[model samples]
Target: MSAVRGLEHVVTRLSDSCGQGHSGSLLEAPSADVLSCSMQAVVYYGVPGDITDVLPRIGEAGIAVWGPQDGEGRDMPHARGTVSYALTYHRDHGRYPDGSLMSTPVLEAAGMRVDWDRPGMPMPSRFEGFVHSCDPDGGHPVYERCSTAPKEPMSMAAARDQYGTVLTFSLGEPGSSAYQYFTVPRRQ
Candidate 1:
């Protein structure tokens, strides 16, 4: 599947004009104040995972932008959801399904900023991620160190290669074209 691209925006601050705090499902409170705040950090609402593919220096920077859609589902001028919050969620509290927190060093390398430790802010209960491999289908190759079935969600444990090189992780669906198109660059 070809990637569905959207415009990229750099959020520098979160606006609180609506007088709401970052608690509750971003999906439910469509009118949360966090949505209109400065783009500096992950505010409210979760977006589609494809933004990670276009964001700069990911795993080292910040969340990808998942632009908003119109009534007909066309890309709107503004973004509705963010992977930044999810990245911040992983940075502050996300644990694997087995109870282990992610330990990827590159995720904290710093290019994007997320105020993940707000004292009383609430976050999403679950997050989806995509793992990349050399295979165009994002599948784990037979006899290879790390692998996943094409388009199927895999555990972080299953995504890590024997060499300890993690491909790429995203909040998008594993089978998404944006996820599959993401390739882990070699060290060279």
Candidate 2:
């Protein structure tokens, strides 16, 4: 809407740079070109769900950073199968099997950056995102509201069946630590 269109893409320039120096120092004066190119926003719809506990269970589910693993099943740092962050969601309600709730859903909807779960999977995600509640609430009229779950290779259901209520997450630069949102739990 015309109302929200007024504000958008607000970012400040960076003044520092990383470099090796002869003075035994790190981050020399930023090269003209280096400082010239501003840092592209590093944010997207980061679905940060909870893992009933936050450790072990998630350990079993490998993120396989770039893609699948090698024959030995070790993630090659420079290879496609490196390790990425593993996420889990839950409800503070009950347990599973008999289907009880666990933790909580922190984002409206989330997904992997790419779909590597398919046959002959193509290049991973170029960019992945979900609409912040503000985005849907007309935060920016020019921005389209992304109200949906992420796609294949990045889906939680296919990965691990976990769900919760009050999905919450941050908004922007000074974006808050956590904002709760919503989701359907498989608990009965």
Candidate 3:
């Protein structure tokens, strides 16, 4: 399937699993320099309480959930919890529709390589063995911290390179601390 279509399918499944009244929108990499070869989307919804129980439902829809780490663990007390998904897709005809090259710096930082010459290859899975930090101060000293910590301010190119074409689903009250914590910065 085409990358866009695949992303749409993921959105649909997530919406279904999460129930009605949710909204979705397209998201672009915050930086012009960090172009992706695929489309991106984000789904937003409200949860009456903790989202812990809803996680299994999300998993049933075939998306992997990376973390449900609480605010205390990540040093962000305002956030009840946070989770992330590394959306993946296979390139159509082995290339981006606009023929853009994935950011090399992002791949290098993640210790990954993309075989640009190969057609219809699946995007590489996220580099393993690192946990993203949610420290609001962006001063976590963990050795295995993910390069793309959400709460930390990052360059647009860096965000694009790390997330690529992705679909994010956020659960929380709009304008609440949890919601703000999940919001990614658009400027460098």
Candidate 4:
């Protein structure tokens, strides 16, 4: 089967298994936070044989995969001789602010400043641009930066106090357009 077809098959099997609520099922429904926080679906699967032929097909499908070693650097358990992989698919919603895109020049032309020296900010070279909407109360534009590097973590309170309402952050994935987008509400 084609890569896309293969992925569809995997998704179908997983969906069926989860819907059945079978004990010891490999996949489970995502949490509420995972649903709200991002526009992506991740599926984990294990195979009882070498994936040498499957890897190329997965690459052609442009799906991000993580396997063998998990987040904690431990080898994924896959019986006596098997491989496990996590496939990530990012869903495209639409453009921000009425489908009109913004560039770096446009933001600068509008008198909005790019704060580069903020702690945990990505380097200038990795900066892509910004997507912003005006704060109606004061006609100030709230900006969100897109970058190719991950920013250091900061508390929500600290970020709001420092950047006002919107916090500048990075989503670093080499050669991928999955930019991280976050918005913090104004402090009450």
Candidate 5:
């Protein structure tokens, strides 16, 4: 099987049996410099066919896709979140005049590299251990953190907010990275 076929299969299986809806997204680390590419594909279950057309609306909201020559465009493929196979081919260049793709693999490969090394950060297994706790803010929960501390106690300091809430972090020493997370109440 092809790699994309495998990727599609994995994405499909993950979208099918796991979550509450038919939504899935992929995020890789390191973009812009091209050492790694962050890819995201999301499927929202029970959504209308129009639900999938949101990217263009977002484009209309003042974002531009620069096409293959300028290098900031996206070629979306296989975006069917409605009933099975409602619309097999749905690629629209609505807000982006130059946004189109002749091939999927070629476009996605623009950022994918074989020699990429995954950057490691000290991730928390639960919501705790975050120097500053905040809401999901708008991302998926791919990691957990300690409610109090990590499995191994590594010395890290906390910078508290005005309310005495911890909001930021700095490693006691260099050469270490952390996956910090937290929640902040909205100030209306």
Candidate 6:
């Protein structure tokens, strides 16, 4: 299937299965980028869909998609607890929003290497390891410790108000991807 067609198909499927309420946008990435020439589709299901069955179709489409890699130790057909599919798709496709990359430096400073191959810091699995500090000038080193073991994911606003940065990935239904990154913000 063509890239755009695949994206549209996926979005339609997600919208239909997830819920009646859904919204999405298609964005074009630079041709030089790894993403296909077609616009990258960003879809948000008001109620996240169960991808237990949809997972196989992603490979058939020959496109890269992403979402919460898995349900937080739960069975399939569960809503993602942390990261959004759009955020994951943007990072994988190198379409970064400003300040999103800030978390990398902060993670590195905390002695966590950014390695995707291993399951640890900098990876979504270890996202809860770091949180932002209100003191941005002092390098925002003051991190509020949250449970490393996945319990319930924190909301973006709650994380920002309390810790000044977010450090968690949603546990959502399965999808495809080329790469993925988190866009945690620091206090303004």
Choose the strongest candidate by TM-score: 4
lDDT of 4 by residue, 79-147 (tens): 111112211110112123455422211001011111112223322421111211111211122332222
Candidate 1, 65-141: lDDT as tens digits: 23344586433432223334344434455455567654322222222322121123322222133223322221222
Task: Return the lDDT, model 2, position 90.
Answer: 20
Q: Pick out the ten consecutive residues of candidate 6 with the lowest summed lDDT.
A: 10-19
The candidate that wins on lDDT is 1
| Per-candidate local distance difference test | 0.29, 0.24, 0.25, 0.24, 0.22, 0.24
Clashing pairs in 6: 65-176, 80-171, 80-172, 81-171, 82-169, 82-170, 82-171, 83-170
**TM-score of every model versus the real structure:** 0.19, 0.18, 0.19, 0.21, 0.18, 0.16
- Candidate 6 per-residue lDDT over residues 1-188, each given as its tens digit: 22322111111110101111112237643222121111111121111232222333332443332322444532123222212332243344423455333222110111111112111232242222222111111112222222222234453334333432222212212222211111133222
Error of model 6, residue 167, in angstroms: 19
Q: Give the better candidate number (1 or 4) by TM-score.
A: 4
Provide backbone clash counts, one per model: 15, 19, 3, 0, 17, 8
Poorest stretch of ten by lDDT in candidate 2: 34-43
lDDT of 2 by residue, 1-188 (tens): 01111111111111111222122227663222211111112222221243233322222344222334457754333232122221221231323445654332221112222111111222233322222221222111222223332222233232222222111111321221211121122222
lDDT of 3 by residue, 1-188 (tens): 11212222122111101111112236642232221111111231222222233333443443322334344533122121212211111223222457754321111101111111112232242312112222222222222111232333333234334434332343322343332222222234
Distance from true position, residue 175, model 4, in Å?
A: 15
